[model samples]
Target chain A: MKNKAALIFGYNDYALEIAKNIQDEYSHIYIFSLHSEEDILKNKSDFEIKSFDLSDKWDYISENIDLENSIAFSVLEDIAENIFLTISLRSSFETLNIIALSNNKETADKLLMAGANKVIPLVQTTAEMISEMMEKPIVKEVFHKILFESGELKISQVKINSSNSYLGKTLSEIDWKVKYGVIVLALVLEDMNSEFIYSSKIKNHIISEGDIFIIVGYETDIIEFEKIIGSRINVHWSHWSR
Target chain B: MGFFSRLIVNLAYFINTSDAYQRKKRFFYDILENNRYPYKKYFDIFMMTLIFLSVAILIAEVKSEVDENIEFFNTYVISIIFFIEYILRFWISSSVTELIINRSEHAAMLGRKFSLWRAILKIIKVKLNFVFSIRAIIDLLAVLPFFHELRLLRLFVLFRVFKLFRYTTSFQTFVSVLSTKKFEFLILLMFSSIVISVSSVLIYVMEANNPNSPINTMFEAIYWSIVTISTVGYGDITPYTSEGRVVAMFVITAGIAVLAFTTSIVVSALTEKLDEIREIKTIDDIRKLKSFYLICGYENVAQEVAQKLKDSPIGIIVLDEDSKRIENAKKDGLVALNYDPGNMRSYKKIGIDLSTQVKAVLCLRESDVENVYTTLTIRSINKDVNIISLLMDDGNRKKLNFAGVNEILYPKGLVGIISKELIGRPVAFEVIHALRNDYYGVNIEEILVDNRMIENTMYVSELNNSRYRVILLGIYKKNKNRFFFNPLDSTILESGDYLLVIGNSVFIKEFEKYLHKKIRT
Candidate 1:
């Protein structure tokens, strides 16, 4: 069933973000922006988008008038442009849900007066971020990915079970692949990543409760094995596997 | 029970073990372990074999239990125990420590470890530790003066069950091997169990009616079969008939080989898995510290950079993989952990993630490549962080430069530039030595500013007074990456401009006084 959708007009990257988050839920979405074709083409992310200039609404509507399936919401930073786009989309598609971003209280009141279904003010969000950045530079990176420029390897968590032959032994004696074709990156326990990578051949580095191994494998293998790897592996804590 | 009493006993035992006069003491004293020699392992096994043979001989040699040959029996039994303990000890104790320390052929002959006589001496020597331990007293009772008067004590010799611990290393190795080979060895163990069960049934079927048949039932037969296979060969029981004897012989040889094979494999497996001690990698070995530091990654320049930083009392974190460098660091008592700071976790190990505590992080890893990475990770965490790094290869300068490091130390390129001056004189070397040692390490220190200065004041002298007692070395004009090493003295110290000074507590106090004056006004 195709559900009624909203056209996210212009909240910069957040427009695409909203569309992506609810794209599968809603049947359709349309994003309009001033971003150039070159900028859009340069991005490698896999998001489906179709763009058209707001001033050329007549030609856009005449060519592709699919307003029956969607709504229009302008997230443009400028007040005059957002109001013009909202009024234009409403005049043509009266039943469509209209939303727009506002820079201030007066702008939000203006957007609402122009027949927007709702108006979200963006100044408060920027004001909070401004305060944060001014205070802490260290916390900013913590909120982003830590890139190891030269190191090619990445670490992730995996669990152990009887299907793996190295249940009772340590890392030094296990034949990592001969027994199971998984290169243990590191053991991730509750608090820290352990020093040893227990291969199939290690005899003394015994697998214990809550021991998660960081394993590296081919992407396809990892995907196929995720059902067995990531989920809780129910192992009976006993002397031998039943 | 008392502390001094325990100490006294322990010391006395130590002196006994360490004494010069004691012959066969090393083996008997067993100072290396639980006070027993491993040669006793082979001896016990031999004695068990003899016991098995003696039981067989008693049944085979005498058809009647009531015998007129008590003297012959006594001589034979006494000789067996005597030959096993004394002769074997004497025989085994070759090149023994008692002999070596005494530096005489006679003492060495007695002290030779393998000799049964030497073993006897060792046994007596061990009795010394029993002076305090209850277990030791019981052990002495089982072997000695009590045994002479009481035949029960002689029988207590069978309490030699304690000899089992004597082979702990081998046993531990075997257990480890079994544990590692848990999956593979399980199959063989199952097969061995079947074989043992089958042999017991077969013996019970064949020898049910024969007198003197040790196979009284399936259980006894199975037990005997296991004992024989494991080479325990206790002489308490033996097969009577010729048919049973034939089966026993085959089982004995096969059992010996299988047990030996299992033991050897386990020992080899255990030894292989024994040690996997992880050594700290360079740079990661450095522990976290709060601010103001220098790190010289390579050995060549490390000495100079470390010396200079040491003079300033700043926390210096050095990381190098070379053992020689690590050993040298150990002598210095600086916070260090061996690891590649270029690697992801290693950087975190040195607490790059906690860069707030560290005022500036120096990328002094092995080469320019690592330095570039160190700079990148450090900067990615703290965008405004002060970073100074080395570049051995000129080609790597662009990469390190892009990483936002404050300064790059290019050894070869800088040397080429320095060669331009003092061609004949050693003034360059002296300058290099002093700079490396004490020439006020740069690219560090806080920039204090008067927040209340007039917006248009351009010259530094307007802000200069005893209240701002420090000299204005430089100003970090906001939004610019360039630094003036020694700023023009007349340059403006605006409200936003930072006054750089070589820090001292007194100078900093006076400078803060300027800030107090600004607030008062």
Candidate 2:
């Protein structure tokens, strides 16, 4: 398994913010771009770069690239190019979960068919963002601030070790709601490769040995995963001993 | 043996071949033992044939000593056939019961009661029962063997024509259409009321004094109204008066209008709602939806904001004129709209106020004035609603405050700012264009949060600490009417907090992956 990321197609500071979000985890990620106002040298590093000519369609993903670990996005001015690139990437790497920047419903549809794992059209997403802010501002604010920017919220991956209470514990057993302000996204099990620990796929997710549980919470909330359940591993695959 | 017994046996076997045969066998043995019981359907066939054959033999005996010879040589062959038929029926039932016994035994540990209750209670055991569906109580009537002899009584089957009720798929379809378009149906019903009332009054006034008029009483006028509206003009009740004729014409027209209205509503609703269904089921592999970003209205500004947020992996929920925006969002892999956003109820329908769950609300409505109003409504109920409104005028930016807007943007102004940068700082635009281009040297971006540098005390110190090469800058925060460019080192870091740094464009997005923990180890 490797690391991956997507550049949300935007020509402003917003694009830079999203890109920086994913740089810390991967060794070197790919950027499907040739230019930007916000310089990446200032705040982020360790990324492999590839330029896509919307006019020429020159984006080719390298082979042996675990598509599940690769992210692609377009923030350029051309809506049609963004859609075309997403589709082309999808055809070559069908399972390469695409995160595309769409302009409207039509483009979004094209992206989905092109195998974009996620499509974020500007108007549609903005409307939802506003509606959510209006509906529940505080909790959303805290979550947004923590997960996005301007806060101390960190979501980490911790492997279950021999000593913690979570050694044989199911997700439901932790009672995360009352104990700590944390949400368990997926329990990573070495054997449960068939199970990607989807947030919604909540059945038959047996967390056994050599499995990793991917959880999201504040750095403080991680004490539960570290102290109560399992010893935190470096998450470097080389150190993952059975 | 008896009429009722025959019916009981016929119904039992007709519905349940296995259980019914078992019951019949028990009854058959009882009857042989001289236990008094009524007749069964099979008994009728058996007894009648027995009597007929016996009578034929007796006649033969009388005619030329033929019956005497036959009776002296023959065993009970007819009886033997009847007995064999009975035994086969019992054997078939026993074998069937054996299957259920084995299945239930294996499933015993599951503690589920295994029963083919549906098969046992199945009204129609075969295609022949479909005949029963069209005609009421066919099996019940045919049970009475006497009906076979009484030809006049058999004519009563003409009344069984009512069983068409079961075969009415069209009528059932119509009913479903009516229920689905219940609100539209109610409107049509209102129109029917007008027709009925108007016709009832007109008929009473026109025919009350006429001795020859068939529309004499209120009930008769009501019945005529129903027939006229239904377009079923059964001429038994004719309106002889001019006034009644006028009302009848209006009723006919009104009926036609209401029918058309109902049809239109139903057709339109089906097309509109079904399209929504098709779009919603597109996305399959979504991982988690922390919060839904509900855009208040569908405007240009909302569209731009939605694109920017979604590029960053934040989920978007759209509420606008077209409810289909929600479905489109879902297929795009964001927690899209499940309901409307403006109407508080519709907002709840879309998961707007579902506790502290939604990530953020970016209010990019068409009009800042309208956004202020909408934001006000949202903020009143959910005080924590993170409202980011689109403002056209700088003045509206202040107005949005009273409504509790968390962030405000002007699409034109933002565009103007970007364009100004294009002119004022050419290198800035080049950097952006270069970073956006993958071929150039790695572009720079700043991640607000990352795991490795969580305890990096100062912005500069944090950048230095990261193993991945990057830069650092002062963080930005709006504190008391001004944007704080950078704060002091004493700004102790919380478990979940922000950072200000500079890095490669691709790596910034990579940073969010670290935050989302999307990396594979």
Candidate 3:
């Protein structure tokens, strides 16, 4: 496995939060501050802070990190700057994964068009939706366990290869929940269209090589499911997330 | 106390304290005075129809000899209803027994002799006050036609038109506007009366004795003065003398001034009441709603919630003190009101029947303190209304919880968590977001297992996920008050259980239809 690194562009609360959360997941975390010298000095944090301007080249980034194994977050508070940063990173490093934060729908669309792998719209709509869904006590409990209280539950995607035993079997032929203690949420087809596992159109559809199954379970249970199914955990497509 | 007096006091107390008596009085009060009562509209419609029908019959009788049956229906049925309504109004206007009981209780509390005579006089005073009120007088006159023997009382039937004022809210608002401008109207009346009286005397003195003039008497002169002052200009009684013409000129000018003054007064009063009337209409519309979500502020969170719920079956009403925000919300095609969300009276003013009509309340104010206050106000109004508030600051989370907020949403924290998840498990986070946002028509829905399903003895295995095209995430057993996640295939489904499923929304609807169809078969 290649060593993973994170290059977070923009030094703000959201950047700080992402850095802090993913600190242990990656071997190195770098926060690129776009502000002036005084402002960067004022923003003292545990992560390594480096100053960068919008017009700068990626010489320092390329020298310091492996571009192919790194993830870059374009989370500048300014929407225009964030889009520009995403474009610049994508133009500089073709293989680096780029994620951007947006405040509204228009900016989100723009960020995606500007070469971001994924755009997280930091709008209140998602919050309201979560609040509405939390009205159900069951949902609240499940989400609380998954996002806050318990860290054991993991959602992982596994892609079937040619040698997998379940490659030619239909979804209905397997009782994954009873046999493996994991719930398969959806399946990504060869064309990248995702379908719910229980969808009637895909009920009898045979799983084959390159088919990705999105599943959720405890970490141990997921790994066991992956082992028994003869597949490896991987994200097949960058845009397949949504 | 004397024995007779004690008997009277005991009787009054019994009547005042009896549940049956109080209930009957309350029923009448609800029908007559409580506009919020659901049945009041029906009562109002019935009374309006009766009044119109009786008036129509009265007009028909003047043109031709009406059929005896129709005449009897009009004379007896309509008048009897009016009479009963008047009696009910009078009975509910003030409680005589309560006044008596209260007076005697007060005297006893004061350690003084209870004067029966004074109490009787006080009761009469209160009753007389109601009887002499304009509404009561109108009610009395409307029922006067019941005395068929007195032909003169038939003219009083016209007063029934005034009774319509009590039934319609618009008329009540007009009356309120007029009442609010009482001082202005009084001044206008005084000014016009002085002008008319002085002009009438001047014309009478100047033109009554002129032989060639058409005004031959003081009465004619006074009539001319009134015609000129009203600007009617009948031309039948024009002043022929120059002095009389001069007086008429002054009266006409004063008449225009009085007309302008009256118009200004009424216009200003109506303008002042326009907002209140509009609010009343909005409240009436809200009262008619079967279920609605009350968003306490028209901020971003509220705007998003309202937009998302716009296509839903439930109604949405946004309230904020900032008129600009309300206007923006209105432009977004939502029912918005410029009302202070923190004020307890706003709930009452908006007619939020939380126990019945209000499905939930979202306190999404920008200020944490305001959200807490709104939650407290809503909880104070009704304890069972589901309240969700956005926590503007982390420090206010406990405050919001203590204020009885059902759910507290921290948007920044939620964003932080999502950002973190995106870094660690990007695909999973995106999948959840897509499900929540209903991306590509996929979403989560809850379907209730009703009595039909229970009667059919359905099992979890019977609801095949592949067949239904939906994944059963869990079963919320209402009886157990617990959710059974990933239940076994043989788990028997029961009534009141909510099935939480995830799938394409269209497929979910079809699956629900199939469930219903299966039960029917």
User: Would you list the C-alpha lDDT of every candidate in the order shown?
Assistant: 0.50, 0.51, 0.78
**Chain A TM-scores of all predicted models:** 0.44, 0.57, 0.85
True-structure lDDT of candidate 1: 0.50
Model 1 iRMS: 26.5
TM-score of each: 0.29, 0.32, 0.81
Candidate 2, residues A99-182, lDDT tens digits: the string is 555657887787777666545455443444443344323323443443335355544556666655545655544455346655
lDDT per residue as tens, model 2, B1-521: 24653354455445455666668667755443221234443454454455355445544645576654455322245335434533443343233333434444544567755444433334224323433442325433322222424545433333223322223333444455446777777877887887788788789789978998888898999888888887777878888888778877888887777668866887876675664444333212121246555556655655555555665545555665555655465455554544435557755433334346555565655667678877877876688756667776665777888889778755434333332222222222223333233224343233444444444333433333233433222343323321122333444443334444334445555554544443322
For model 2 chain B, give the 10-residue run with minimal summed lDDT: B279-288
Ranking by lDDT: 3, 2, 1
lDDT of 1 by residue, A1-242 (tens): 33455456663545654565555545656555566475467544454455656664655543454555454557675779888777776676655556566656687788777777555444332222222222222221111111111122222345665465445565655534323344453454434422232222133566664566644433444444545545333211110101
Error of 1 at A61 (Å): 86
What docking tier does model 1 reach? incorrect
Residue runs of model 1 more than 4 Å from their true location after superposition? A1-242, B1-181, B187-195, B198-209, B242-367, B378-388, B431-521
Q: How do the candidates rank by TM-score, highest first? A: 3, 2, 1
Rounded to one decimal, what is candidate 3's iRMSD?
Answer: 2.9
Candidate 3 structure lDDT: 0.78
* CA error at residue B456 for candidate 2, angstroms: 9.5
DockQ of 2: 0.03
